[model samples]
Target: MPATTIHLVRHGEVFNPNHVLYERLPDFHLSSRGVRMAQATARYIAAHSGLNHAAAVYSSPLDRTRETAGEILKALNSVREERGEQPLELTTDERVIEAGNEFRGKRIGHGDGALWRPENLRLIRNLHKPSWGESYDHIGQRMSDFVYEKVGEYPGEQVIVVSHESPIYSFRHLMETGSAEHWMWKRHTALASVTSFTFDSETRELLAVAYADPAAGVQ
Candidate 1:
């Protein structure tokens, strides 16, 4: 049996005191509240019989995602320990990394080097095929590639992947619809949310897509 399910989890809120778009830059870890959110989501997954049994855990190479994955590993490893199974290690993959953006450190409000400046306006004209940086299609394809490869590696098993909002949602949009293009503002991937995809073990066909925000109540 090939990997049947992959849970794509969005990382918790980041510690961006400056409120600038971090976008692939380094040093953006989770906040204290973000850690709590990640813990809540991790507990939810750990208590779930299926998710707790995940054979592998992966994450985007970014700090926030790795931190979120770390929380999940703690909970899952505790379950594995009780079951006398070896703990799972975290694997960082670049495919699920945050979507690149030109406005890496730009603020959103009306001030110096804001994202809405006239010069930057040209880059944001289209959200679907966004001219800013990485296109949705590319993100979707990379995520798709990572998914199918993992599916092949772990047959009849479950896997967890922690990533940022855009990559998760873009991949979900690509899976749910034929196209990855979507209204950017309409994305439903919340912090510490999980979007699970089930695939036919033998045929590699998509079986179902499910979503859950275990940390929805977290502020």
Candidate 2:
């Protein structure tokens, strides 16, 4: 049986001049530099022999993810056209979205007024389960389910999934270490990076995992 590959891609930087945690908020699109980064990522994937043959593309419903996926689709379609093949369809999956955060819209800097509030301080008690918002296990489970479903659907082919930083990193950590209890400070999933996984075609078990920053040095 042939192996199947899935690429979990993190979206580019957001246009947040305020530097607030946009977590699941609406209208938060990618910045201008982020658009360039997205384009560069798409080009990189299109040029990659292993990933350019992706059967389908999926992304989160957020604006940033949608925009990033659109750029990827465009680049992938260009490659398909060059190769005389049809373009793959793009779909949205809510399960692959950013992890929910109770601190949404609140500035977390040292001088920020919201960071020093008594109620906000109380929410920081648990870093393992993360009391401020969604638990790591929850995000890992949903991401795992999504990956299983997609790998099953597109056996022996590649599937591209565009998602946020936390979900992608959490799922990658779980797959790599078999544990999702680590603190967020350890993860360094960069913008427009690709974290890939290969699975057994028959058993659907994870066979290998890899990471790449296609848009590296493209700040």
Candidate 3:
């Protein structure tokens, strides 16, 4: 087996006018700016010689992630056509979906919302394990499992996984430091960002992790 690279991509901004936590909700698609961001990311990946040859592409089942992955698949297919290769297929993986949150559809702000209600204070008591929603460790474990499975399935090839912010951030943290403790400041997973991990082909050990924002200039 040869060294393989897996790119964990976060989906573009969602069209949530209510500004609520749309965790795992259905029918939440990407905004107009998000569409541009997704297209920009797809173009960037297609332009990169190393990343354009993706052997497999996986995405979360959520609509936003599916839409983002759709753009990437289109770009990848275009590149493949230019190279005279077959188009790559896209797969949906539930493990890469957004972390479950108790405050789904709730407005989180400084005002008197459900997040600030006295009854919901207990949910914030354990930010480390994150009593508010899915535990950090659980999210990390699922992400790790998904990555390892894919690595074995596609040895020596580049793979892409489009997921949500928290899951990607948790996986990155867990891989980097062997811990999944939730740290507010460390959650800097930008929308439509690509966080890549290089792993040894035989040993399957992580070699390096890199982060890039293809839609950096796009507002």
Highest TM-score among the candidates is held by which one? 1
lDDT of 1 by residue, 1-219 (tens): 454899999999898887888899899999998999999999999999999999899999999999999999999999999999999999999999999899998987888988889998878778778898999999999999999898888889999999988888888999989878889899999999999999987888999999999999997
Residues 1-219, candidate 2, lDDT per residue (tens digit)?
789998999998889977777899999999998998899999999999988989999999999999999999999999999999988888999999999988998876756555657878899997878989899999999999999998889889999999998999889889988876677888878999999999997799899988889888786
TM-score of 2: 0.95
Best by lDDT: 1
Global lDDT for candidate 3? 0.90
Mark the regions of model 3 whose C-alpha exceeds 4 Å error after superposition. Answer: 109-113
Candidate 3, 1-219: lDDT as tens digits: 488899999999889886777899899999999999999999999999989999999999999999999999999999999889999988998999899988887776656564677777767886667888889899999999999988888899999999999999999999988997768566878999999999997899999999999998998
Which 10 consecutive residues of model 3 have the lowest summed lDDT? Answer: 108-117
Cα-based TM-score, every candidate: 0.97, 0.95, 0.95
Pick by lDDT: 2 or 3, better one = 3
lDDT of each: 0.92, 0.90, 0.90
* lDDT at 211, model 2: 88
